[model samples]
Target: MTAAVTTEHREHYLALVGHGDEAAAVDYALGLAECGVSPRDLVLDLIGPTQRRIGDLWARDEWSVAQEHAATHVSEQVVAALAARHRPRPDRGVVVVACVDGEWHALPARLFAEVIRWDGWDVRFLGASVPGPHLVSYLHRHGPDVVAVSCSVPTRLTSAHRVIQAVQDVGVPVLAGGGGFGPGARWGTKLGADRVAADGRAALEVLRSWPLRAVAEVSPLRDSFVSDDEHVLVVKRGAQLVAVAMDRLADRFPAVHGYTAAQREATEYDLGQIVEFLCAGLFVDDVELFRAFVSWLCVVLASRRVPPETVDLVLDVYHDELFDFPRARAHLVAGRRQVPAGRQVAA
Candidate 1:
């Protein structure tokens, strides 16, 4: 059937990926393609959702990081196998798909590239974490009709904004995609994309109807940046803030002192992530962004058996440290509420 990969197919394919069965997964996908499931549907409906499920499983602690990575590798292989099997004519214009600088998640961008290729566009995938000047130079030489910037995490929005600015500067229409753009791609509009496509299908819709070479001739929205510049100031204190939180962590949460090397590393990462997410919310002037991230982080830490008080302590330390910056302090307070059974950190 030419229909989307049904639940039956998804479960079957996931089993292969879950077991790290790359050959079986690829063969199964190729079989589906040969049996009439279109390439776009195969990627969007099957591989895409499977990748997400892999993330969910990891966040829930059902899958180890190694397992998650293995499944992801298999999924990548399936995408490549499918691409090699179904070649599309690029009657449409050239499109370059790349992850924003500092964003290492390349699979989503690769998936999008393949989906658009099926739509008859010649897509040049730049893999993950493309730096600014490099991307701009490529735009100059390649002169693509559109450049799709992918950022999977909110922490990358600032990087995404820089890439969007660079692409627009080079006169290439910028299309912002992925979770970094926030709900309804509001942050994408804030960053000044010619258009925002949530996924590859929406990208095709916009690209197909996009006016003739709009990137070369028009700017869809004016460039945007933080008005108050508080985020700029707060970002500079990243290391100092992390050190203070870690320094004070043992006062309330003594368990951290006894952590093994891996646990300590993970704990440090979790602490750093809080600052990154807070800065991201500050960049966009949206407190809810930080709140959502805090909630998600709480769940993730809880799954790993981390006590909620550890978060409370960090937020308290950050709140006190960022006292001079009103917006940063407010975002910290908002994030603190999301921690389960959280206590206010006294200044």
Candidate 2:
């Protein structure tokens, strides 16, 4: 009976948010709490998985940005209602949660914060993309037992690395969590976090075992890059590469030449995203990162009626332009391989 109810609730909750019915969703979550659903389960089980599905819906092109945003906002409201209803006293040590710089997805961090708060730790959630320096200052002022850094998008891994290093430098142990850290969050260890968790529930287990770990005992950041300068050079030259790709795209597509200002801007943004993802893949020394991004980009573009072959051309131009950067070229090759063989190289 409990399993049946859980399934029904999951389906109903997803439907509520999908339609942007925030008040109803919040009511439903709170009603579950009233009906003996543990607050922790409400967050980690219901809101968290639903939020991820919202992301997946957007990724699969089944939902537009507006719909995704609406669904996400509803989830946030549900989380808040639950948290407000069950504010456990902070018996455990204080812990701060923050999204890494440039990671605007704060819901994951918020989910962790609410869960830990219910578990009795005082959670200070620094919402949405706190800069490293500012975060360090917050740590100094508050002196939490640890800080959990969240990064959802892989492109923000460089910023995550910097923030982890910066937080550890200031005598605080860092707990790295979020999707950006790659599978199993192996990249989090590479970035020098004291501990890593793949999600809020996993983070809870990590904190329970070692909530007050000292700074000096944490693992130092590993040197993951083969050519450290390649990622940096890609970022530094990103604008130039985008401009070059744009010009070349106009030549190949011809349609780009007739693009309106909005169209041109959007194209530039897409090209820039390609470079950004490439830089991230290089930063983490993972070809799979670039390949994954190319595959997803293909789906996104295809859903929007843009030719996936455009990504192929962009990769080719990037490969040619980054000829001097061996690592960059190699990752681009991986990304190129992800593009469906829509057209042959333009000789």
Candidate 3:
């Protein structure tokens, strides 16, 4: 049965976890569970929101990385405590939950696994970043009803396609989730996944209705589609791209020019993400994948008091560097469109 989660209850859990009070947070969640609040609500309502808030706090500079990591640890403890008290009914069929290769954000996948287990499905939670070969071997051995693939970052979409194809080759259907799959599961469908779930509840609904079938020969999408030499070329030159962009940004923007070693490294990391997401967008043949990331990057830069035009400068640098690659140039053009024209640095 689904339990009601009051706003007060939600805020209470957030306060406990945010303060690094893992014991109190775990106790508070367990208390709610004992009161009959569904484990699903505990995950989706309390812990899930808290995790997002942690990221928001860090992005706004209100919380340090240490604080974010500590808060995440607290949330993990709460989930662990909840899983210990609740036992699966075992009447529902088996499901395997795992993060795609190269995806380290395992909390969402962990929460989804526990919620599915509480909903009566037998779950084998394979933690984070399960390699393709190992995952296929596990599926062959256990043969679960469905596989839930979780991805949190857009950069991992290429790896996700590989995982989706690998699981499908063994005749197992995949339900892709996480922000990495892109808004509305756009990339998931393009990657040829059987289904996509926006959240834990939606994942459960899809799993319930999924059709079972025998293992058959499922052809891989990568082979059928035209070769993605553009993606490969961009990825192969990722380091050079970041290096050149970093040097150019420092020359073009005073803020970047005066950055400390740590700040320069951060700038380098951002440039690297731009290149990676660009490649990922190319891989999926979708402009929105790169566009969405640029939009979000603008917001993050604004939060840090950096001019969003810095993103424009980086895009311009890439345009000059990759002029030979028309497809890459086109994706960069789409990304630059998302940023506003005026350059106003936050003070």
RMSD to the hidden true structure, all candidates: 1.9, 2.4, 3.5
Provide the TM-score for each candidate, comma-separated.
Answer: 0.95, 0.94, 0.91
Question: In lDDT terms, which candidate is top?
Answer: 1
Predicted model with the maximum TM-score: 1
Task: Put down candidate 1 lDDT per residue, 1-347, tens digits, no spaces.
Answer: 46568999999998999999999999999889888899899999999999988888899899999999999999999999989988977898889999999999899989999998988889999999999999999989999988989999999998898898888887788888987888877788877787897777887788889974644545446564545788878889988998898889866777768889997787678788888899899998999999999898888888988788888888888898888998898888888888999975432
lDDT (C-alpha, whole model) for all candidates: 0.86, 0.85, 0.83
**After superposition, which runs of candidate 3 have C-alpha atoms over 4 Å from their true positions?**
1-3, 214-227, 254-260, 342-347
- Give the least accurate 10-residue stretch of model 3, judged by summed lDDT: 214-223
lDDT of 2 by residue, 275-346 (tens): 999898888788998888998888878877778778888988888898788888888877877788754433
lDDT, residue 27, candidate 2? 91
Q: Write the per-residue lDDT of candidate 3 for residues 1-347, one digit (tens) a residue.
A: 55678889878877887799988998898888888888889899888987887888787778888988988988998899888888867788888999999899899999999988888889999989999999999999999988889999878887888898899888788888998887776677678777788888888887776664533423244335444689999899899999898788777766777789998887788888899999988888888888888887887788888887788888888888887888888888888888878332211
Report lDDT (Cα) of residue 90, candidate 3. 79
Candidate 2: stretches off by over 4 Å: 1-5, 211-213, 220-227, 342-347
Give candidate 3's total backbone clashes. Answer: 0
Error of model 2, residue 62, in angstroms: 2.1
Please give the range of 10 consecutive residues that has the lowest summed lDDT in model 1: 212-221
Ranking by lDDT: 1, 2, 3
